[model samples]
Target: MELFSDDFTDGNALAGPLREIFAVDMTTATGRCAGCGDEGPVAGMKVYAHAPGLVARCPSCQQVLMRLVRGPSSAWLDLRGTMSLRIPMPAE
Candidate 1:
């Protein structure tokens, strides 16, 4: 996927537009990892712009830390995650 300077998808940079299009929540709630279950200090949250919606990811394992869904009383889509870009191999 083409990486944008900002976290917002399509470089819209507007919360309202995104909310209208996808489900999202900004206020994030911290929780222990379901996979590892090490609750000392969870990895920092990062924003990831996906096709369906924005997602949060744990820096430790690069797993989907959280998902943002549009809520009535929510603001911007909170995403604490990272994205991996796959550079297409040159045609042989």
Candidate 2:
């Protein structure tokens, strides 16, 4: 139930803004779901971009993990639904 059966897409749609905020490829990052406690890479989550903002939902429990609302002045990002976001460090 976490993933949508119809039009859910990958997190690649959020790569641009994620890079600008985290300075790294965040779509490949891992996020722990706050609802079902499931942990997985962001790329596996279901993304919906047709709304006023982009919404990413957990693939395990269908809980909203993140939302990105782009405004004319500044973009508003909400990640309260995500338990934690783990960004991989570059290998030396």
Candidate 3:
């Protein structure tokens, strides 16, 4: 059960690891919210780092957008909460 209402932070908390996953800056990446269909940058999401894993939630409807769990051997990623993530490719 959740006991604290102030346990949430901004998406800057996940910037490091998320950057490694996508190999790019996620702040510029657009994410489509599955809950309310809101489309915006991932950096706009609300992040909860109080748990073992980091959860990114939509700022519009407070819906989860992403969940990341780092383990000794591997890392787990859950993007089911987001309908789509648009990553921009650099020009060659």
Candidate 4:
């Protein structure tokens, strides 16, 4: 049996949900995968939204890069799978 479903959307799908949590566009940010050491734009990751929340995985090694769950009044974000994320910010 398959442990994971093949149905999923691209990282671009995360833009709306993430915008609620971050001030910047997270899809354009770059992240380093803890499992594979691969660094790339979050937009290049694969996003699965069928679960209770959103799960984003590395495109190179398929390692989970992040997870975001939204509640009625709050939101939870997990970045355990990513070593680090470089989010762009506008300079004043």
**Best candidate according to lDDT:** 4
What is the lDDT of every predicted structure here? 0.42, 0.87, 0.86, 0.91
Give me the runs in candidate 3 sitting further than 4 Å from their true place.
Answer: 1-4
Cα-based TM-score, every candidate: 0.36, 0.87, 0.87, 0.89
Candidate 2 is scored at a TM of 0.87
lDDT of 4 at 29: 94
Tens digits of lDDT, candidate 1, 38-73 = 331222444465546556555445456556565577
Off by over 4 Å in 4: 1-5
TM match of model 3 to true structure: 0.87
Runs with alpha carbons beyond 4 Å of true place in candidate 1: 1-29, 40-43, 71-92
Residues 5-89 of candidate 4 have per-residue lDDT tens digits of 5887899988999998888899999999999999999888899999999999998888999999999998999999999999998
Compare the candidates by TM-score and give the number of the best one. Answer: 4
lDDT per residue as tens, model 3, 1-92: 76465668887788898876777888778999999999988777899988999999998888889999998888899999999989887988
After superposition on all CA atoms, what RMSD does each candidate show versus the true structure?
A: 15.7, 2.8, 2.5, 1.9
Report the lDDT of model 4 for residue 23: 88
Tens digits of lDDT, candidate 2, 1-92? 46355676888888987776677899888999989999999888889987889999997777999999888788888999999999898898
Native-referenced Cα lDDT, model 4: 0.91
Summing lDDT over every window of 10 consecutive residues in candidate 1, give the lowest-scoring window: 79-88
